[model samples]
Target: MATEERNHVSNGEGDREEQEDEKMEQFFALLRSFREARDKRKHELRLRDHEEDINKKMKKSKASKLGNDERSSWVPRFEWEDFTSEFEFPRPLVVFPTPYNKKEDQKNQEDDDGLDLNLTLSSASL
Candidate 1:
């Protein structure tokens, strides 16, 4: 009887170990699958972003080319020598007379040399 009991216990332990092995394998497979799905999603997002950037750049380049063509036609050519030959610039007319301050002139002349005024008259008839 004891021998049969011992055999039964060993069989149960073996069955438990097999079940644990299957659980561990299932856990590892789920982890690998989740990581793969996350990486694929990130890759898809990056590709879409790059595609959008390329489209924006293409649009800007096309607009710049069209603008350049339109701007070149509107530019005016300047011939300065032809205008100067036909039109003569006259001198501007003087509106106000040049300011003449007698006080400042006298002050400048007094600073030049010795100049004295003699204003004395003899008392003839009072």
Candidate 2:
């Protein structure tokens, strides 16, 4: 009877140990899930912050490029000058050369006309 009691006690202890081990495993699984969730939340927050920072930088860059303020606006210089009657006109920038030989050009025109007349007469005779 004593031996049976010892065996029963050892079996109970074994069962308790198994229950404790199962509980520890469940706790560790919950801890791992919580850690994963925390890491995911942190990553999402970081992405949101990075996106917001990029949007801010883009807005600033676009504002600078477009010159949204009056101080950054460009103004062209357009001053009117009053000219007096005594103001002399400037000389022409480009000068063309006169004909060098007008007689030679006239002789060439006469020779072309003679050639045309001869062609016409030869074609009529043919």
lDDT of each: 0.85, 0.84
Q: Which run of 10 residues does model 2 get worst, by summed lDDT?
A: 115-124
Local accuracy of candidate 1 as per-residue lDDT tens digits, 26-70: 999999999999999999999999999999999989989877766
Displacement of the residue 110 alpha carbon in candidate 1, Å? 61
Clashing pairs in 1: none
Question: TM-score per candidate, in order?
Answer: 0.50, 0.52
CA displacement after TM-score superposition, residue 92 of candidate 2 (Å): 65
Best by TM-score: 2
Candidate 2: give the clashing pairs.
Answer: none
Query: How close to the true structure is residue 113 of candidate 1, measured as C-alpha lDDT?
Result: 64
lDDT of 2 by residue, 8-121 (tens): 999999999999999999999999999999999999999999999999999988877775563535686754554434666598567788777989988878756655534355
